[model samples]
Target chain A: MVVYGVALLAACYLIGVIAGDALGALIGVQANVGGVGIAMLLLLLVSNSTSIKLQLGEATASGITFWSAMYIPIVIAMAAKQNVVAAVSSGWMAVVAGTLAVLVSFALIPVLSRLGRGAPKV
Target chain B: MALDTLFDSLVELLARNGLITAFLFVGLVLALSNWLSKVVTRGQVHGSAVAIAAGLVLAYFGGVATGGSKGLADVGLFAGVGLLGGAMFRDFAIVATAYGADLGALRQAGWVGALSVVIGVVLSFVVGAAVAVAFGFTDPIAVTTIGAGAATYIVGPVTGTALGASSDVVALSVAAGLTKSILVMIGTPLVAKRIGLDNAHSALIYGGLMGTTSGVAAGLAATDPKLVPYGAMTATFYTGVGCLLGPSVLYFLVAAIL
Candidate 1:
């Protein structure tokens, strides 16, 4: 049953990759565009759709949940493998650019929050 | 001599099955990180963040110890780390995170939440690109990659890879993203009350504007556990939006300017 989840994921990933490649071609770029993100959106749609959910059953649904929780560990592995020393040594640009982005983004929060105040509560 | 032979064989066996070894090794790291988060930081920092920081440190030390470029994977026993952390698994894991999101809940956040996601991605990209230019990075590819990194760590590398930017630039983008994640994680609780981040509505906007799911989720957990899902929901969409725009539209915009 868990394997079914992986199968579904694989299907989504392949389709996403193809779609991304096509999109890239359409836009005149030579690489995949948003394949992972597209795959995620597809998964979200399939997982939420009543028809698909009914076919997937409870066991397969749990398989999806199992992989979802795996995100944290996988991300940790990804982070651990990055060459931080090299990145830091290359220049101060990375640090400066990142810090400024966060600071500016943080500053904009209040302004965005205020803009949303006019909308009625959902 | 017999014991030494057995130890050699064991190491070789593990090395041959590298993926399994990586799983075991990362499991230990995760366990340790979770413990540290719970016992040492009192959950002030999420376990994943701590694990990532630890992984970075270990990678630095691994590179130093081995005098190699591949980091820990250069060591005989940890070779599987390379494959486990490769782009294939990374993308797979990222895509899997969307499994449990509720569509109805997304609609509840309304149009403002949607606007925030777009604003968050573009704002971060513009600021990041500006800084990249300020630092004399005239290459549009590099500038776009770095700007994408400002959107989120995931977006940065994705953009960089798509644009065929140099590895060094990609690494820089990732570092930039990690910097933002840590800042958002630590800064959220402190700024919560001041920014009126007390309810689902504000949390959704906060998630969108921040756009780092881990940071926003952990920050919201610290602020209010109930708000985590709402913040994380929009933040997830933020990554999607960033990825879609970074390589295509955003890259063209930067290329036009430069």
Candidate 2:
């Protein structure tokens, strides 16, 4: 199962990257199929965990949605790169942006949750 | 001129082996994502219709990685096909609770962990996009690094839910934050130099870099066990310092290059 999962991940990545470009070209926006897949996987694992139990279907759907939304950062990052077109064409910038987005979001979670609590009364 | 050449070279390389490059890039991204999810789901792990969707991504990248291209029809077919992993790992707590497992009371804790991953992704992406837009450029790569730093440093422990050592997790987050700073300090300057940006202009690249790292550090320190609120105050302080250091060095390097 583990090996299968790993294989599946690898395969998905390749398709996401290659097809993303062709798709991106047609749409006039850089496509990050790999980014979306990873995001989906992340959500998939999170949702499935006996620990979270967000419900399989809901978690799966949300996972995709959240990951797709996460792509915004990659778009922004490429735009910020020295050559946006080349960056998108190469897709390295997207990889870097997507990785960083995941990391930053993961880190801030605790702090945000704490802050989400109403301030303690004096 | 040098930047242009490098960019041109990258473009050429990509164009020549677009399929291969795409596969490599996607493979790494998914692999990294898997590792990260392990940290979150602890091996618990995607979609239906979504299933074919994932398979299409798989088939396309796989074909490209293997030195070929999938047909448009195949790609479309794969996108619609979906897979279901049977069991949902996230609901472990609830399942246990129903069975009256000793840990049944901890379901909310599990939910916390799940929420951390979901919310973390959303917040960082939005913030990152805003930051990029403010800079008048949107490079997905930069936003990713900053967002990951934020997620790892800030959200890691909150998402931990006692599945593991919070202290250890916090320490790991610290390591990650430091890594972010170092990567930026080094990466920005190299990129700046490559692009022929004058030394004076490099600072702009480093600004958000620091903000991200510090945010994570603060989250880590704030959640650690050793520091009472007062001690954590110190952690918070350190986080600020770390945050400040990342961009500061980036700016200095940019300035030097320009």
Give the number of the best model, judged by TM-score.
1
Kindly provide the TM-score obtained by chain B of candidate 1 when compared with the true chain B: 0.64
lDDT tens per residue, model 1, A50-105: 88888897777676667666655655555556555554554677778777877787
Model 1, position B158: C-alpha lDDT score: 85
Residue by residue across B1-258, what tens digits does model 2's lDDT show? 999999888766655664444334434444554565466546433111111222234434534444333212122222111111111211111111111112221222333333333443445434533443344434333333333333334332322222232353233333343334323322332343333322111111112223332222222121221111111111212222222322333223323533
Cα-based lDDT at residue B111, candidate 1 = 83
Which lDDT value does model 1 have at B97? Answer: 59
Q: In candidate 1, how many Å is residue B152 off?
A: 6.6
TM-score of 1: 0.73
Local distance difference test, per candidate? 0.76, 0.31
- How far out, in Å, is residue B205 in model 2? 31
